[model samples]
Target: MKLLLSLSVIIGAIVMASTLTCNVCNFRFLFVCIGSSSTISCTGNCSLTQTFAGSAPFFSQQACDTNCVSNTTTQKENVFGLNYVKTCCSTDLCNSGNSAKLSLSLGLSMLLLWLLKCV
Candidate 1:
């Protein structure tokens, strides 16, 4: 029973830590923001990472391209060669790094943790 409880705790920690996080700036809050950047930890079906690249960036529940997985799009929000890009990915902070490399690292890290716990 003790071993089972310990394993449950470890697994719970892993799950909680594995939640999806995304760069959310000027989003969802009615109050004025103190900074231009912040993070949002999603829950349930809101499990996706969205990134918007533009001079005036914004995101919200309706603004987010929810259910977007492994997709990237480039759009022109202004004149000149400037482009406003919107990207979506799965996993924690995956929009910040190359998804392929991050996936490998995440897999390895989870494996390592499980292995450590076992040994």
Candidate 2:
């Protein structure tokens, strides 16, 4: 039983790690916007690219970044004075700039609690 528990915990971590969660927000529809912001709520795999015109949102999982500032040059894109944010994160809902990172944040919290219990 102990071994099984350990295995499960490891598996859970792997699953979480493999899963890519990001906050996707696009305000490109509005031209010459003063201030635009998206609600941080939506969550999905890093492989998602629905808000693009003719390019892949994320080239690969490695392309995703939890630290928004660090990957701003790549993930956080600005076009025509509008923003097309695809904030990617590996650690739960680290992408706090768009509406798709809430669920991942909760999932990360749950995972942490579970790990603590296992210990």
Candidate 3:
């Protein structure tokens, strides 16, 4: 009986530590150039892309242009008996500017409290 109780406690602890969690993150980048055409590439959770073309309403037709690209990528790994989920992505792509590489951030779930409660 004592051994069974110990096993249960350990199992509960592990489960609590493995609980799922959520995270919120946002980022941006800027590019400058003579023209309004540019190419952007990202590996991961690529989400939104906004491009500004042609001259501004108030500016001349020869004015500058702009663009934005975004994406997302997810990866999983386990360490020290804990599991981790990594998500990364870009917010936007720019035109006529230098090429850029954006990486997304990873998040972890918190389950310590839940494990203790099970004990």
Candidate 4:
């Protein structure tokens, strides 16, 4: 039982330490963001950026960014006629359509189950 518990803990730690993966895609024209067909892994965070003209989003890009920081920067519409917003997250496949919160929840649930079974 002790050995099983140690093995389960090690597996959980390895999963938590794995590199983050993010969707990679670029689209323009409207607010609709098509699902990405490709993905990339990064040591830092995944980034999703969207540009808006007036109040509507017109462009979006998502990919792995080693230097990404979680924040939003907006430009005055009068100066550039557009606004830009970038979101950075650190998690596996966080830049995809799936929510990071959901991923975290599932991971925790699995770990708890494993620990319970071990005990």
- Which residue runs does candidate 2 get wrong by more than 4 Å? 30-44, 47-119
Which has the greatest lDDT?
Answer: 4
Which of the numbered candidates is closest to the native, going by highest TM-score? Answer: 4
Please give, for residues 1-119, the per-residue lDDT of candidate 3 as tens digits. 99999999999887666432211112223321212322333322233222222221111111111221232222223342322222223333211223233332211112355566788
Candidate order by lDDT, decreasing, is 4, 1, 2, 3
Clashing pairs in 4: none
Answer with 1 or 2, whichever has the higher lDDT: 1
Write down the lDDT that model 4 would get.
Answer: 0.69
Local accuracy of candidate 2 as per-residue lDDT tens digits, 1-119: 99999999999887666664443333222121112323332223232222433453322112233333423333334563322434334454454323322344455676699899999
Candidate 2: Cα lDDT at 112: 94
lDDT of 2: 0.39
Q: Which pairs clash in model 2? A: 40-98, 41-99, 41-100, 42-99, 42-100, 42-101, 43-100
Model 1 deviation from native, Cα RMSD in Å? 18.2
For candidate 4, write residues 34-114 as lDDT tens digits: 433467767778888778877877767777888888666665557778887888988777766532222334546776998
Which 10-residue window of candidate 3 scores lowest in summed lDDT?
56-65
Question: TM-score per candidate, in order?
Answer: 0.35, 0.29, 0.22, 0.56
Cα lDDT listed for each candidate: 0.47, 0.39, 0.30, 0.69
Task: Give the C-alpha miss distance for residue 12 in model 2, angstroms.
Answer: 0.7
Counting clashing residue pairs in each candidate, in order, gives 0, 7, 19, 0
**Comparing candidate 3 with candidate 4, which one achieves the higher lDDT?**
4
